[model samples]
Target: MSLPFILFFVFALISVGGAILLIMAREPIHSALALILVMMSLAGLYLMLGAEFIAAVQIIVYAGAIMVLFVFVIMLLNAGTEERTDWSKIAKYAGLPLGILLLLELAHWMAHSLIGRTPANGAGSANVMVSTRELSMQLFQKYLFPFEATSILILIAILGALVLAKRDE
Candidate 1:
């Protein structure tokens, strides 16, 4: 087996385990830590796929900035361990099968869509490196509205959090 394949499996397993941990953890802080582990492993996977810029953004933006915000909110709220809830019979019986169906549909769609597509390299190679300048141009030119909207949404979330905090005091 190739080294990259093995590394992919390792990172994939770590990410999946971290996701499970994130879901199962009772404490909000522990869940946040697990999410950080998942994000870092995803960054490693991105690096393995030759997306160095995306990997760096994943680590810096998600792991560093976003996680700090999440941790700060958790601390500010004085969040405690989660209380166990009893699941309804309908959810318990139907949710898993519906989730599995959704997963299978997604897999089918991805398999069909990616079957014969080569990486966007003109030379038909897999290691196409997207320059930062090109990426910025695409982001600013094509995706400007969506990007600005996302920032506004985040700002609103921050303001909402502050309002809730003030109300509690």
Candidate 2:
């Protein structure tokens, strides 16, 4: 097998394992760490797909900044282990079947969509290298309004958070 194929499997396994651990961990801190592992593995997969800029953004924005924010909130809140609740029998029985059905549906959709599609390679591939300047130009020129709106929304959220936090003190 090719090196990329092997690396893909490795990253996929780590990502899946991390997701499982994130769900299963009782402690909030451990779950956060597991999420970080998942994010990093996803970044690796993005890198293998030739999306270096996306991979770097995934690492820097998600794994670094977002995770720090999550960790800080967890610590500030003094979060503890999750409390277990008894599951109703109907939910216990129905949830598994429903989840399996959803998984099967997704798999069928993916298989149908991918069956006739040829993987792109060479110059025709979608993985063309784009310069940061071109990317910034597109972002600022074409997507400027949406980007600024998003920033404004984020600023509002931050201000609301500060107000709530100050109110609590």
Candidate 3:
């Protein structure tokens, strides 16, 4: 296989593996770290596709800022590994096959969707970067309400975590 093909496969594996690890990890911190890996792998994939601006945004916004928020919340909550619980035989037997089938279906769908949609004009070089002024104007004017609502939601999340972390009866 060609080198680029190999790199794509490797990054794809890292993305999938990190997602699976995030789900399977018992500790909140481990899950958060796994999520960071997933985000970084996605950013790498964006870089490989030559959308450097998008890659940088993913690294800065999702991987850096959002992940820091997640990690901070996890640490502030002092969350620990979940206690082990017994798995039902039906869940283990049926859920595994269903999950695998869903995974296969998703893979098939993605492959088919992407196969005919290669970047036009070049190796993703045709992606247009929006101007900083346009972005700021949209963020502050058009999307201001949504942005403020999101901030409120995050604040609520932090407050809820604080309340839940209290030891008071």
Clashing pairs in 3: none
Worst 10 residues of 3 by lDDT: 120-129
What lDDT score is found at residue 137 in candidate 2?
A: 89
Q: In candidate 1, what are the lDDT values of residues 1-169, reduced to their tens digit?
A: 6676778899999999999999889999999999999999999988776677898999999999999999998998999987987887888899988989999999999888866685542221235656678888999999999999999999999999788768553
Sort by TM-score, top down from the best: 2, 1, 3
Q: Please list the residue runs of candidate 1 whose C-alpha ends up more than 4 Å from where it truly belongs after superposition.
A: 119-126, 147-164, 167-169
Distance (Å) between predicted and true CA of 114, model 3?
Answer: 5.6
Best by TM-score: 2
Question: Candidate 2, residues 148-168: lDDT per residue as tens digits?
Answer: 999999999999988887854
Report the CA-based lDDT of candidate 3 relative to the real structure. Answer: 0.84
Question: Clash totals for all models, in order?
Answer: 0, 0, 0
User: lDDT for each of the candidates?
Assistant: 0.87, 0.86, 0.84
Task: Give the Cα RMSD of candidate 3.
Answer: 4.6
Candidates 1 and 2 compared: the better one by TM-score is: 2
- Give the alpha carbon lDDT tens digit for every residue of 1-169 in model 3: 6665787888899999999999889998999999999999998888777667678899999998999999998898899989877888988999999999999999999788876686442333334544556767878999999999999999999999899978897
